[model samples]
Target: MSSTLAEQRAEWRERIAGIGDTLRAESETNEDLRQLSPATEAALRSVNAFNLCSPEELGGVNAHPRLQTQVIADITSHDSSAGWCALIGAHESAWLASRLPDSSVERIFAHSDERWPVTCGSIAPEGEAEQVEGGWMVTGRWGWASGIHHSDFILSMSRITGQEPEPGKPPPLLCAAAPKADVVVEDTWHTLGMRGTGSTHYRYENVFVPDEMCLAGFERPPLRGGGWLARPTVTFLTAAGYGFPLGVAKRAVEEITRQATEHTRTGQRASISEQQHFQGDLGRCVALVEAMEGYGHHLFEELLAAPINSLEDAVRMDDRARAALRWAHQTAEDVVRTAHEHAGGPAVYSDNVLARLLRDIQTVSQHVIQTQSAYIRRGQHQLGIPVRPGL
Candidate 1:
């Protein structure tokens, strides 16, 4: 299965290479218009590129987490927006793997096989729920729901029906899985870059979610004895989310190297690749990429080998995983910056690939997952010190 998954990803890589230029062109226009292109959407669905993270048990080949990021990086080298959307959509299956019932999982595959790929979900606590006869009624708005335009189903998080809250406490987030009919997708994804991601806000109004359709992290029945596999879904989502942009940074470095070698600096007749200074800079970038990749793979392999076991165990693993995420983001940021600086002014021009790569890298790097402030807070909290706000 592993070999097959690798082979499949390789095939997808080749497909991306073949269509990368087209996707890039379309993506550029989409960025200009602040919307996604139909061709870009069709191409992704054509390749089933969004299914890369689906678990093997769900009639989808679940590739290794490390390899998944590698493929995403490859795609990002071609088009950042497509890579971001692809990874986001593909990761939807990973989050659903733990919570969705077999029937719903099958339905996902059934529709996916038909070529309607869905992505983006609301898992944060930002909704109201009321108890009903058979299930619960949930209504709320989830922002930053990327890939919703193409999604066939939308996952919204809402409070459990009849749930009580303390004076200052908000309701807990429950995973309310429902079809797109239950929510309205707003095309509000205007941003600096990665416009093709179609990350918009979604609203749910009086949506009825059956018991089987709802999944919550802080609430779930424990096994009679014990089972590590039944751990919370939040851990899985957090771990899988980092793969996309990490891949984008990897690709940015590659493109930067390619462009750096072909173009000469203002003062030099030879390409940057021929210069000692450029060589040194590129080498550092490569080393950072290598080290980040190694650490990310090591930590991810551990999680996959164990999956989720216990709350304490998951928490411990999350610490290491978060550390890996930080390294990946920092190294990626440094590498992209090096690439941009080493590539020079011409590479910064709109027509240059380095410029686009730079924009995409920057756009995705600004996400909360890669934010340095979050890392510091996590570290401080782990050290038994009070976490400073916005640290």
Candidate 2:
């Protein structure tokens, strides 16, 4: 890494670590309120955590993928929900900032002196957009709109109503960015884990998105920022996605290790740390997290370093990064489960960190990107079978 980049990474890591106590202190309240606590949000804003991936010209770090991943992992190590929100918020904002027309970008960043804008939206093409004179009228209810409660802009992916693709081509999709005031947030984010993300469903009914505020497709090259933004969006997103599970698993390991020192099983005489089984399990968990981190960082570095000259190249990078993420997710789930199981009765209590780690990991594992289909697709590719295009 360049000296400047290394220094940048160190600064971000320290900044995130500085807020660790605040995140931990507010975690329970955040869960109860189904969103980040005010203090937690303020701490994050103080460090510009939501703008890490945004363009440098727009008062953001414009961090590299590896650095961004580390930032997410570090933040997640303190609180998974906060980490999740940071990940989603940063990426969404950067996506819009990089793709939106100059007018929209200027307007969105106009208030950066007071507070940098945060964005939340769904990329799934569940909404429909009807073409009109200047822009499209969008109407749909998008689920899992994380950080929507605190977002300045809401984005939705929709299919253009009258556009049909040629044979073997995907349908034309448009992404519309609207002011948060233009959308209605539904209180439907009650969940098993990562509840503090406030990932509720949001509705856009006949919302007229101006032409300048929307992108024609999801995979267009960025109009601003460095080469990092030019890479396939899914590839870096996959890189960032692993941070939540990895951090949670690392936290699980830390919590269980600490508990092992003072925790004794109900029927056992020795402390949990003294037992061979507990020791071995904790050792395995630690190794799993370390390995996952190394693999993820290495894979992302390689993916970003390679030149993506064609669609095939982008798909190849996306597949590799995604496959690694899936493994990391499954491994993280394993680590958290093992830690919880061995932590015994205390791990079940709501106050216990292990309990929350377990729930967060499980919830994150259910994300569509972590599904088994990635594995199946990888297997098909290796077996000389025709795999579907794109991730």
Candidate 3:
């Protein structure tokens, strides 16, 4: 299975290369439109480009966590907005694995195919649910629904029925899934960067979501899905989410490097590359970005190797995972900012590739998962203190 997974990953990488051949020319237009262009979307869909991190049972290519990360970065190197959507969508797949019952999997697969097989998920638990016969009636408004435009299903976090907690207390939360047809999408993704991701607000009211669609625990009965699905979903989601910032940072460095010899001071004859100071900064920035990737993979590899026999063990692993991602995100921000400065005036031009990269990285830095709050949470975790929810 691993071998097959590897072969499929190689094929996907090749496909990414093919798709990238066209993105540079269209990325600006797509970002301006606030959604993927029809031609770009159709071209990507033709090559099964959006099926990263899918379960094999659902016709997924079974890219492992590391491979999935690489895939998002590769795509982001061409188009940050598309990469952002893929990052969210791919991690959402990991978030859903082993959570859905076989019936739900069958249901999703019944209408899905290689061309389109995954749903987009909201990161926060911001909805309400009412107890009903054999299930709950879920209703709530959620924001940051990235990839909604292309998905067939949507996953949301909601307070289960009759389980509302007191003020300043936590409520009973369940991750629920519903078909996209039952979701109401709003255009709310306007931002400084990643304009094409279409991560807008959405509403679902009184939708009957069966227990099968609710992920009550980390495989309480252990959904028959194996491999990474059997691992903790939250930790995996945290780890995978870093891929977005990493990709944007990498693209910034690449764009700057290409223009290094072309940029010069107003009165200077030597290009930026010819200036020792700029060269030194570029070298350090590249090293930092590359080192962060190595660091993330090391921590993630260690996480996958760790065993989980108790909730405490799972929390410890998650803390480590979140910390590792934090390092990557914070470092990615620095790398991109350095590259932005090194690239000069062109970097700030609205239509320049460096400008887009800067915005995308900045946007990713503000994500709930990648924020500095994670540092505090990790510190608390290390001191054996209970951190906030979602850790």
Specify the highest-TM-score model's number: 2
| Each model's lDDT | 0.66, 0.85, 0.73
lDDT of 2 at 274: 95
lDDT of 3 by residue, 259-325 (tens): 8878896777899889898889889988887887787677767776788888777766666677777
Model 3 worst lDDT run, 10 consecutive residues: 216-225
lDDT comparison, 1 vs 3, better candidate: 3
* lDDT at 79, model 2: 92
Q: What's the distance in Å from true for residue 3, model 3? A: 1.4
Write down the lDDT that model 1 would get. 0.66
Candidate 1 on 110-225: residue-level lDDT in tens? 65567644656867778887878877888898877777777777887776656677786565557777777778877778676666677878888888888767653534532111
Q: Assess candidate 3 and give its TM-score to the true structure.
A: 0.90
Order of models, best lDDT first? 2, 3, 1
Clashing residue pairs found in predicted model 3 = none
* Worst 10 contiguous positions by lDDT, candidate 1: 222-231
Off by over 4 Å in 1: 1-22, 106-111, 165-170, 210-212, 216-235, 238-242, 267-271, 306-309, 377-391
